[model samples]
Target: MSFNNANGGRQLTDLLIIGAGPYGISLAAHAKAHCLTYTLLGYPMHFWKHQMPQNMFIRTHPDSVYLSDPHESFTLLRFAAESGIDLPVPLPRPLFVDYATWFAARTGVRFTPEHVLQLSRTADGYEAVTEGGGVYTARHAVIATGLQHYSYIPDTYDGLPPGLVSHTFALTDFRPFAGKQVAVIGSGQSAWEAAALLHMAGSDAELIYRRDAANYREGQSGSELIQLGETFFDLPLEQKREKQVQPPGSAAAFLRPYVEGKIRETGNAVVQKAEAVDGGKLRLELSNGETRLFDHLVSASGYRIDIGRVPFLEQRLLELLEREDDGNGRYPKLDAHFMSSLPGLYIAGPLASYSHGPAFRFIAGVRKACRSIIPRIVRSMAHARSGSS
Candidate 1:
């Protein structure tokens, strides 16, 4: 399938995946194995290379980091053995990105390397507008954009100007904040990590959280067998709810030694709220009512899952899909096969986690998602042909 010139001037496919992240790539690989025509768009590992800090590491264990394939030949362990690289537990970011690129090449999964500017529903299926002035139509579409669009800044800092406030997701480097007084909000991994990075980069950084004190994840006693089903990825919806006890922003994984030491040395800080004051600085009201000014504030407050944040999703298409909100935010209702209210459209990755369970938020979730969705896609294709005839 030549995606570039498939139908002359424009491309078309049986399945259109809008992201090339872990989930997106995995889905495309499955579609190919099923002998289904599919087209993948977007830069592979774009966030891992650009949005994340250079020195950052994935919280997931090396054994757990993977994209699902039919033969299972591209496992991290297999990749390490083939490449002769020592794969550690907390895998380095650069190494993982390399593995992803290598996997895509080995699988022979062709990608368009274009951004999907907008998406809308069509009579037969859907239409996607690309940044390169290309139009693609597909009988089915899956959204795998990941958490890039879901980064949330608190409502308290709503009135603050852009430069004075930002989120950790937007910070690729800390050198720009050198010699400036920066206040980091939240006590989770991103918050503490950002504070440490800022301080190490020559900024006077401090972490402030609503909790009494920071809580670090306790170390495990011993290594356990790494199994997909046991990892909570294959659990039923009710069981998944029981297992996921931590709050949304809480990081169950511990920080690296160097970053932890830096945060501890800075001492504990708590905040009640923040307000904009003179000189374009933020005046933070502490729990004890003491106020302080800072050059900038970074909200590591974490992501709020809202379906509407996806800018490219046309409003009409969005409204047509059935959604359920649990007071926090709205998420599309998905079936057992991860198909949305729209018969042919599917939702994967973090966005579908709410309906399917927390397992959809991790790489472990990709296996089940692909296994379930691909077979259903084949069935749908067969049904469509039979109906048209």
Candidate 2:
């Protein structure tokens, strides 16, 4: 619950983890099992609690939505059974949040409920300053921050006034837009679902996307991509790329029927650009050469994993970190062990997807990430201690 330095100075640990979302909690479970001294900082499942809509359902199947526990006893399904909760496939968000909390408690991964304000390198390892003036020092730091901060608001609407436009990730509810003319941009699941929620809330909702139609995962029984088992990560880079051919943000097959029938009943219409208009409204320039206005606009365009947007990293340390082949801040260039160019610093979760491939993007991927990286980290720490002694 708390890891404060009683002496009002830096509390030293072997590992410091930021963000207690699914990835952070999974990594904390692994660190606990390894007997590594670590301090995890962040509210558990903060994004799910505050950002996602209250009635949302996860796209991942029940079987895949689990945090990695070395003992393998605690799982979403198991938690549901033990708690006498009936679980429907494509689990509900509330149930998953409860399951995550149960798993964190069951795994004994204590998290310090604080935000990391800044992270900088130190002579020994790294230093993290928290919101409450608490400083933590560790031999290494692992960033498990999820997609919350990376929400993508396209440049097309960048100059718009703040109240006129926003990302779907920023809104937890759509009730405020009731009776208002709202425009939901993008053809992805988020866009479709947001439109549906807006409609349910009594808003006049319209959808816009560049694509001719909304893309959804096809329901194919025993598909190779879905059946990717424990050894999937060991495949060649080309093989991984083959599986990642599916573009991001496409709706899951399980929700396709509902979304298509209820939300995007009509196919997508092209939107060339969007501009802010008077009275806190937005003007959409359609590819069909017509302009329309809406009282509010929500971009469900998805997130861009630009590392530069991460505000906590010190400038000097940020410059030292390597970037992906594109040499863009969109992704970090990580080594085989998921360590960045800077030694003893690791990147996990969706951020690791660029290097580790598609599997790193969701809760399903956390097990593989932890299984692969934890042992390496333990070994490196051991070696460091021996060398110093």
Best by lDDT: 2
Determine which window of 10 residues in candidate 2 has minimal summed lDDT: 218-227
lDDT (tens digit, per residue) of candidate 2 on 1-389: 23434233676788989889988888889998999888888877898898888787777667667788777778887998899988886678898889989998888888888888899999989998888877889988999898877888777787778888879986877888999988888777788778878888988887777676767775333223333634554679788667656564566666555555555333446557887766777888887676788899888878877788887888898889889874456788887778998888998888887777666666656776777678888999889779999
Question: What Cα-based lDDT does every candidate model obtain?
Answer: 0.77, 0.78
- C-alpha RMSD values across all candidates: 3.3, 2.7
Could you estimate the TM-score for every candidate? Answer: 0.89, 0.91
Write model 1 residue lDDT over 1-389, tens digit each, in one string. Answer: 12343232444579889898888888888999899987787887788888988786677677667888888888878888999989875677899888888888777777877888898988868888888877888889998888889898878788777888989995988999999989888877788678878878988887777666566764332123123323454577577667544463444355646455465322245556777788778888876666778999988977777788898999998889888555554788777788889878998887877676666666667877888888999998898799999
TM-score of 2: 0.91
Residue pair clashes in candidate 2: none
